[model samples]
Target: MSNKHTTLRKPVLLTSLPLGVMSFLLPIYSKKLGMNAVEITGLFSILSLILIITRPIIGKFTDSFGRKPILIVSCILFAASYFIFSIATTSVLIYAARIFQGIATATMTISTYSIISDTTKENNFSKAFGRIHSYKSTGSLYGCIIASIILSFMTFTQGWKMLFLIFSILSIYSVIEVIKNIPESKKIVTVKCDINKNKSRNTMKLLIIVFMTCISSSILGPVFMIYMQDKFTNNILLLAYAFFPALISESLLSKRIGAFSDKCGYRYSMIFGILICAIISIITPSANSILILAILWILSTLGGVLYNVSEKNIYTDMIGESCVGVMYSIYSIVCDFGLMIGPLVGGILYDNVSHQAPFYLSGFFMVIVAILILILIKKDSICRVD
Candidate 1:
């Protein structure tokens, strides 16, 4: 990679470090802070709702106003929200912090993706995206390891708050890197949104797939920590182990899969990924040993890495370069809707049915998503093949 690519990749990695840390620790800490399942679900739902509503507007603005300004403002807000979260001791404060965090989180991901799509060519897009995922995974791994150590020594509240403070400072550094090193793409692709545009239709399809996949995938988010905490007694270690597979998948597997997709086709890759995840889900909950659970988590992470890479490529291929921001925004909104619903539904289902219900439901949806992808590929055969 060139210097520019290196520069772009740095901020992405830095920003994701904190995101990765918080992704697991936040909810677990929420429980430590005395919030119940209902409150936890409500907080995430609010975040998802805000992201669903705000992503499109942010994307559209990125087209006109440029990515840098949006990124700067958003990163500041993102970092600041961590401080808010650190100080939040009550359910109401947690909810408010998450809301702000949700809004701020949107820009980092959307703008970074838009920047990559804008800067690179079609042939390089998958590789670039893979690199981004790799960095993201690396950050996640580092965060999990660090968090695990921190939690071992400190109370959950102390560890979580300190983590936020450290990550917030890192996020600020990322902003500085973005301003100084990452240059804006000179080629601006203006979107001509028309009812008849094939791109628009494709964007809609991509959004639908994102929503379905996210809903299925996010079902384990809220309760996974609690389940591990109850079963293993050392929640931090289980959580750390659970995410280790994801780190490997993101850092190593996703890039290879992405490169393979460029030659073999994204549709097949995506379908294969979904099938693997569905199978894992069907069997994972029955694991009688920690070893089995770890193996299953790795399998699931591999599947997710494959699906995420292929799905992102499909979106980029369908929407083209000019409308990347808009396409991703729409994609984010739909995915957020799924994310919002997943925890709420999962919590309810676990309460009514069984703790394993969420995994079973996730598996079922993954299978459905595979079938849906096949239908989509057949319907849009020419575009997909090309």
Candidate 2:
């Protein structure tokens, strides 16, 4: 491992702990607040919209001011956001909390990602990201287990509130790590000054990949719980059952796939990943039993994991460490923008069309996007850090 990864891994893992718990629980929490399918979907879209609005601004600030400063501030807000989630009773209040959460997340994402780019070896980007994601997945899986125990002990509403409080407290450790242990990214100043002289490829080309893939991937995200609720309910263990297998697979294989990309190239890995995702999404509606559905869901997740990690590698490879905050913020904008739009469309379809329709539409979209972008992205390395 690189010195920087060694330095940053502990704090990153600590920060990721809360996120894991929130991932499986947030939609359920939204439902408990009396949000229906549309309302719940709206919450996700709203979060993404807020992220879209904030990413570029956050990107610019981090790139200009430095990474650790932005990260510390975002962590403080992240802790506060959980407190809001604990107290939220109405949809409006939840929306307010999500906006704050979104901004904090936006900044943290760019800063953290930029830091990885700053510190990791050039050839190790994919492997480094994969390892980081595995750690995050491990954190998420544990969070699921923890969430299950909490839910078993209390009502969903009460358990959720307690979970948020615990999340808030745990976040303090992350804050401390950032302040005391994590180093500021050394590239921030140099990158900020050199962008004008650099002819690294245009942002628009890479953004096309982020935008389309995210939209395809997120189309079913908002409606998934509501769709699954028909087959399973009441037990938080259901969330565990639904997610654990996939999470385990992702954590285990994330590094292998990243290493594979390093050897075979990112383009092929991406095409294969999205192709598998497209196939899985199309067949999800056919799984009449919960067990079968879970299996297919697990497969769907792998495709997404592969695609995401590879794409992150490809983006970092194109941009190098310089201006990464801005580059990734641009990438985040595309992703969140797609995420925002997908739910609104999915919400409309879930209510008007069949619940399964959005999944099918999403799958088809990925197939087209994969084929199109395959043609657009060049085979040559667009920019070389070395």
Candidate 3:
């Protein structure tokens, strides 16, 4: 990787640390604040709904105005979100935080991916994206560790505030890094383009796959923490320990799998990955022991690692370089569409149906995703650039 790529990832790494903490705490916190299952999931749906609206505009700005400014704004918004999370006493405040967080995600995620696409060679996309994801994993792991420690020492309320406050400060540090070190990734360009028919078709197929993948994954989001709390001990440290293996394995292997995807076909890798995850999801609801659940989680994460690394590279391969930012935003919009629906459905299923319903449904959708991949994404489309 070049110095520029390295620099770009630093802010991403830093921000991801806080994101990890938020992921671990947000649902639990929402529950504590008297939110029901549907309400808890609604927060995420609201966030994704906002992303669907905002990401395209911000993504276009990145392509036109350059990546650096949008990235810096993203960092600041992250800090703002963290601060709001820190002070939140009601669901309304949490809702506001999700809004800021969603917008921040729209900007930072699009800008960072665009930067990687701008800086790296086409063939090296998986390797480069792998490293970026690995960095995010590393940061998230450490963030969880830190959160565990904080929760270990303090009351839940105190620890929650402290975690958000500390990460809010760290987000500022990321902002400074962006201002000082990161360079603009691409020259400013207008988004006008005459897209090819094949490229457009491939991009649409890829986005459909992404949408299904999001649904399959997000179906578990609203229920995961609640399930853990009910089934396992509520000790934050123990929860973190259970998650450690998956995070560690994902961090270590993301880059390697990316490199592997670069050599082997992304289609094969993605198909295999999705099937493995689908199998795991099918079995997860049956695990009676915490250890079995943890094991299942680890396997599921590995499958996700494979699927995500390969899928990202394939999208980059399919889209034109000039409108990559817009294309990525569009991709995210489709993915968020799934995210918005999945959690609501998951929450309702958990509340009205059975706890296992979401997992079963997720697995079913994942199988559909795999089928879609097999039929829609042809070998010729993946192997050769049109």
What tens digits encode model 1's per-residue C-alpha lDDT throughout 1-386?
44556676666666666666666666677898899977876776777788888898888777667778777777787678777877888877788778878888788778877777677666555666777788788877776777777878998888888877777788788889878877776255456644235356556766788888988888887777677666665756555676576566667766676676665666787888889999998887777777677778888887777778778777776766565666678778778888877777778887899988988998999999999888876422222333
Off by over 4 Å in 3: 28-39, 188-191, 194-199, 228-237, 351-353, 380-386
lDDT of 2 by residue, 1-386 (tens): 46666565655555566666665677778888788977875666677778888888888888778889998887777778877888899988788778778887887788878887887776667777877787777767766777778888899899878877777677666788788878887462443445543325544666776788878887886677777776566565565586678888887887777776666667777788899999988888777776787788678777777777778877887776566677788778878778777766777788999988988998999998788668876653332223
| Selected candidate, larger TM-score, 1 vs 3 | 3
- Candidate with best TM-score: 3
User: At residue 162, what lDDT does model 3 achieve?
Assistant: 91
Tens digits of per-residue lDDT, candidate 3, 161-214, equal 999898889999999999999887785546554444324777888888998899
Candidate that scores best on lDDT: 3
Q: What is the full ranking by lDDT, best candidate first?
A: 3, 2, 1
How far residue 35's Cα lies from its native spot in candidate 1, in Å, is: 3.9
Provide the global lDDT of candidate 1 against the true structure.
0.74
TM-score of 3: 0.90
Query: Which residue window of length 10 is worst by lDDT in model 2?
Result: 377-386
